[model samples]
Target: MNNQNSWKTLAVNLLAERTLLIVGIATVFTLLLLYPLFQMTPTLQASPNPPGEVFELQKDLNDKFPNSIHFTPFLLESLAGDVLTPNVLLEFKQRRQELFAKDAIGALAAGDLERQPYLVNYLDSETGVLMTGTHSILDPIEAGLIDIGTTLESASEEEVKLAVHRLISDPKTSAVLDFLSRHATHTPSTAMGHEIRLWVSPAMTFSVMTDNQKLGGGGLEIGVGGGPDVIAKEYLNRHIRDVMKEGSTSYAIWGIAIDANLEAQDEGKTAGIFIMFTVIGALLVVGLTLKSYWATAICGVGLGVLMIWLKGISSLIGLKSGLVIDLIVPIGMISLGVDFAVHALRRYKEELNKQYPPRMALKIGLSSVIGALILAMLTDSIAFLSNLSLHRSVIHFGSAAAMRFLLRSPF
Candidate 1:
């Protein structure tokens, strides 16, 4: 039974002498095990990080709007690059087929030379806005009947380019540009009287308060006397409002953002997490001082557990109370709580050190120091928790830390 001992009573008795050093080193190691969570630095005020602006924008968009397809910069560029391009490939295929059909030598080798048409390669490439089917009305084969018609048969590439441009200059494409705004950016640009409406997607996570903060979007209008575009912008504005009032925007956007935020098992949460740890630590404190499982159990078991939970809950509440907390903040808040619990235990140790022998010292310490120290913490906690009233996020941080200290107390 004696051999089953860990360090004997003497070693622990010696530890109680330089109790502060022991506690300090142990506290640091304990925190290191929880090092990841101790990230929430104590603060009386919360200063917003620059990136938090993204969250505010996300909230506003989500609570107000939904159903509108969230466009992203990459998606837009990829879509533009790939859309409506099948026809170009098809045209190239037909050109290749025409060349294969006209190869007289190959036709003869295949026993059909007599039926083959003369090899004539006609390539029409666009110089600018090329369209066709209406031209100078000269077919190379038909024009070859007259001497001047032969000139087109052997037309130079330059002549072909000119002819193609002449035919397509009045094609239907871009004809509407005259009516639409001339501010031609890939995403429309602002040309006075025309609003530049760029629908960047995954949606920006920051504030957008430009000089031209119009709540319109049908076609993005600006200028001295806005025309059709102004009407279009008004239409999109109402369209967006009607959609947002239904509360679909935030969910759609947050779903995408959650992919980028921290995960449940992420070690980074050590920055804000504190709990079972504080309980374990509190037990360690009682064990070292009381010198008996009976004393430690009486002080540290379920009661210590309750303290850990209560304080953890308080930290959690502060983190979740408002739009400001979000998921990242809880990690920092919990870490802050651990610091509080460690300090509380340290003070408890100081009181325990004053009396002789473990039992008498604990009794005297509890009777003398616990009440005053506890009452002080209670007063401090109330004042600390009141910090939640402040606008900055740090207020809840202070409250969470205070609550964590309350948990380790026997009360």
Candidate 2:
């Protein structure tokens, strides 16, 4: 062999041994550690699940010895009867305020219409819309005309409402209300009943059940009536802000991010396994083709290094975890590249075997197949690049593959 070829042979042998050992160790570690982790993944996921009920589970470590490494069972038992979380407190306050508001509006309506400061706006507390007439209001207290006198102040909400209804129905007090109650609830539904409208508090919830699903989204009129109060707006915003800071929402967010990562790790593993196997197949072909252990080893070493480089780059971009074959394709690339070189050399070796020495055989083989080797690679490149026209990502894939050809090129 030429002096140049001799150096090539030595370089290929030494590098191949070190690279192969690294690859083997890595494969073993991946199989032992990573594979087990991958397998245990399902159970790991199952362990932290059952999320939607995190509120019911309050875990507080019992610390009898604050300085020592000691602990006790969750102190949830102590919190049982008094387990009112922020959410419960919020709901209680909201319900309580609604009842209080309902009572206030009731008292306003139950009193004598001839007395009390009139509620100026006919407001729909639910929708925040307002009108001029007081009697058109839904809540009994907004009616300006009801004459309960001071009885409304002392009476229960139910009792106050009854007094207002009685006053509205009294023929002497309200000829128009007496006529309206014949067809419906004494509650006024027009601008003419200004005294009655002032009593309305529009925050009541209403729902109608139906047999027809098509009619479900149709004809719904919801409103809000309490007068515009800037202080309430700020308080409501604070409550919503507090809800967002709760632990359940935080856990749910972290759980989702972790679940995505686990899925990605699994995909990368599958791609890595398949690529490893493909490289092994290429190594076998190199073994069968080359007579020199050093020459065959060159192909394996170059392919392994290329595999590591491609994997490292893909991982840096996080593509390896999410992308399947595309991420692993770099593994098969080096072997494929050098296989062409080996095939070219092999053919010339057979021809020289008849009458030539190793150097003559090697030179002739390289000269004979260099063109064909490069031709095959060009063909492969064209085939891969053609797919780039279909997808933007394929363009990057083609470049990566073309790089493998360059890295794997042996004289």
Candidate 3:
């Protein structure tokens, strides 16, 4: 009895008399801890890396070929017959014009066309945007048209056909045509001649790749504006996809960075909607159970603080959030938070019903459940922290979750 009374006195002193001190310390700690929030860069991967041998080999290859360059491919499939028809080619040409306009980021240019057909970097001096050049069948097609003394705009159907044929027959341009043909095959037609069939594929694809300019002492300059070139390229790729999709054609734009950004955007949108619904549900549940608006508001505020602390702790330790971690952590925290709040509130109400004063009731309610709450925190932390060695993503999730449990013990 004496021990229980002493425990109740401690709870009263800590929660009631020193509430302002606790709040001040938590606010300061959270502010300091949240420094890493601005610097966090989340990475989403399908799965962890392969075993050590394969992973190390891949890492070595990356180190050796650091400037090999990566490309984003934008595949365009015509819903309306051959992709090489005069009308379709003209439309595609127009789209390219929009994509590579002077006002835009620009496209790849050939440094020495006569010696070797290769792309060179084109940087916009005014915009500080570096556009990695693009490789497409259209490049060679345009060259063939120029060789034959006509452009896509002025060329008739016959002229365009001639340009495509010349593109295929020429040794200089044939390699580009062959590479394109591999990805976008000709439409099968028994009636059409073999030459005509070979030149009229229903699909074509283009790729864009940028070069990072080397700075003094082996430093690299990606672009101004913290990778404006990166941003411009993503915008450029998305624009290409949008243009391709305009006329009922099937389109897919993919690159390492592009796809990752797209997936992150999609997941972020989904997470927003999910969080909205979860908040609403939590609010409704807490409000209905507590039957007190103040209590519900407090619960809501507490949940928000818990989330901030969770994120702050994870950020401090340099953990990046993924889709799985984003989804799981909130659900667990909300459920546990609501459970803890409801139990303690109900216990306090019970003490009040017995005619205990508010202070005594608060003390008794908190003191009675403190042991159970601490035990729950320990067990949950252990369970989550146990996953530390499983995978990189698991490590992030586990550490964040364990931090959340520890944070809850104070509450």
Task: Using lDDT, give the best candidate's number.
Answer: 3
> Which stretches in model 3 have alpha-carbon errors above 4 Å?
5-13, 27-51, 97-132, 143-151, 158-195, 198-200, 212-257
Regions more than 4 Å wrong, model 1: 1-67, 72-308, 311-360, 390-398
Error of 3 at 176 (Å): 5.9
Q: Could you give candidate 2's per-residue lDDT for residues 229-299 as a string of tens digits?
A: 21222222222223322333211111111123334435555776677777777777777767668767766
Q: Model 3 has how many clashing residue pairs?
A: 2
- Model 3 Cα lDDT, one tens digit per residue, 151-204: 888876666666676566665545556435354554333322334434667667
Q: Pick out the ten consecutive residues of candidate 1 with the lowest summed lDDT.
A: 69-78
- The weakest ten consecutive residues by lDDT in model 3 span 214-223
Tens digit of lDDT per residue, candidate 1, span 1-411? 553343433343444466678657644544443322233322111333323677567546654653122211111111222211222222322332443443323331111113332222222232122112111122221222232232433544333333323332335322322211223223443422334332222221111011112222222212212223233333332222222223321222111111111221133335233434554665576667545576456444435344335434543343422222323333333333333334444444665565466654544344444455567658766876777643344665565556555644433
Give the poorly placed runs of model 2, Cα more than 4 Å off. Answer: 1-262, 289-292, 308-322, 325-328
TM-score of predicted model 3? 0.72
Better of 1 and 2 by TM-score: 2
Predicted candidate 2, C-alpha RMSD: 21.9
Q: Which 10 consecutive positions of candidate 2 have the poorest summed lDDT? A: 69-78
Q: What is candidate 3's CA lDDT for residue 333?
A: 79
